[model samples]
Target: MGEPNEVAFRLTRRHSSVPRARAMLHAALGDWSVGQDALDESELVLSELVTNALRVRVPGDRQVGVRILLLPDERLVRLEVSDAGAGKPQIQHPCEDETGGRGLMLVEALAHRWGVEERVGGIGKTVWAELKAQFVVPAPAPPVEVPAAMVRPGQCVRVWGCWRTALGVRGDLDADGALHVVIELDEGPPLRVRSREPLTVREAGTPAAHEAAEPTPG
Candidate 1:
């Protein structure tokens, strides 16, 4: 199970602080092993929030607070930005000629959800957004089972890219150890193959020609 991870910092309200906050957020997401798609969206959301904070009516010495949280098990990531200014942000319908009213609009389209709330014990507010992370699951391995009776002389078995007649059962072991069988292929010298169920001989006169013909289980 994965646990929650978080990163937080303060930035002085300045135009240069936008890139600095974005870099820190990028580093934190990388350390938390976030996916590329989520990381890109996160960095964009961070930039918008920071820019809004810096553009608000805050004093020269006021600082912006940035925070990021990752919930791996939940496949969720949250970003928050707090400012000393009391102004609230809202989505605007900017005309085609407009160049600067689309920040919150971009945030709404990129994030799964976003909103603003009053800052605790302060005069300002915090803007937050949540994004869904893309987590990949690995495929399961195939199953192979061989019966003990199948390991014996005169048995036709397919192994090592060729069919071979089992000379004899050198020895067999439990599940933890491999079963040793001496097989003589039609072309090459006699070779010994170890496996739990490499032998393809299910019945006499019926040859299991291909070793890799079996379908892997899901």
Candidate 2:
């Protein structure tokens, strides 16, 4: 039963998109033959994980994401909360009066099983949880087809073949030479990135490529 029966998303859990997540979940899992209670539980799990990721940011930084993966057979759904940090979540049972300290506990009670695993790029981790549902969710909507060589705006993108180098040059400069690395991804959303670290601008396509390095401050 180790088939690739899974759908996962990799979005940053930033402050934005919090309100829309619920509806998105419904859109993703609405067709499945699952109970409303199960859907509620899954949404709760996603919120818990996504909130934890959001808390990682300080006064600065934007929102990240929590991806809901509908397992094959539509029998189970996987919730993965990813972040840009090195840490694992622990489940704690708090007292009745405790206002907090009971998120993971809720997940523990709701999910069939949950655990954490390292992410692919060797940066963060994915807090995974599974809920029973039996989603014979009809054949997944036919994938929106597009020519291989074309990657428009608003699409989930990943860069494949690429190379990067670190060159050091000092002296502060204005936005004169600064360049905005914007890629038009046709499908998901436009990536609006403003950062201080090395940026990675990528688009959808075979052998996808991304430019490394973030925009520096003036």
Candidate 3:
């Protein structure tokens, strides 16, 4: 939640780049620990945006620009597609039998907010959409040091502000005799942390220590 993560890719104006754009967005969202709902919606939005960009008639050398921004604190994901075309995209209401013209309608339905902005010092504009990110609750941390002997698989532990399940203990040990622990998180790839690292663990059917609040006056 400190600083937002941003990634940008220059894409050729071709239909083939649409899937590639979606794939890059998927990988970026996975790294950001975005919820599946947001991820799916973002991919759909990216597809529409990139398709529009590819359809636009830009200068021969002008490449489409795709950028994704993740704002953890605000829980917002923003996507932008840029092209050098002179015309701005507009939503069209097509008849039922029409097979096209529903791109912007779908974007309007799924995104929290969307709009187009003129590119700075450029001949074209950038169409953007933002989706609210849904994040998973992290596991609670242990109040005191958890003995390595007591750690085991299927246990939830807090690491880097996210709750993750312990997969297993790696055979290798650190210089301090702490074991390298493998963990499965709600998002992204598996992680490895030292056993001695301070972590919050989840006990079955019990509330985390931090959830205990002072009792109200009777």
- Compared with the true structure, model 3 gives a TM-score of 0.65
Ranking by lDDT: 3, 1, 2
lDDT score of residue 156 within candidate 1: 52
Cα lDDT tens digits for candidate 1, 1-218: 67789888999977899999889988887777777899899889889999989899867888999989998887888999999887689899999998988999999999999999999998799999999987544333332335434556765555554445666555545477756554554455665555443444533354233234542211
Candidate 3 regions exceeding 4 Å error are 137-218
Q: Among all windows of ten consecutive residues in candidate 3, which has the lowest summed lDDT?
A: 209-218
Q: Candidate 2, residues 1-218: lDDT per residue as tens digits?
A: 44533344544545555545666777677755556777888888887777777777433343354677666554688877777666677878788898998888888889999998998865677788999874443332222323222333433333233322212212233477543334333333333332232333232332322333333211
Question: Per-residue lDDT tens digits of candidate 3, residues 1-218?
Answer: 57989999999877789999988998999888888999999999999999888888767678999999998887899999999988778999999999999999999999999999999998789999999999766665533336443556777655555455666645456788867665555555666655555455665334554533222111
Which model scores highest in TM-score?
3
- Model 1 segments more than 4 A misplaced: 1-3, 136-218
- Residue 103 CA displacement from its true place in model 3, Å: 0.1
Task: List the lowest-lDDT window of 10 residues for candidate 1.
Answer: 209-218
lDDT of the candidates, in the order given: 0.75, 0.57, 0.79
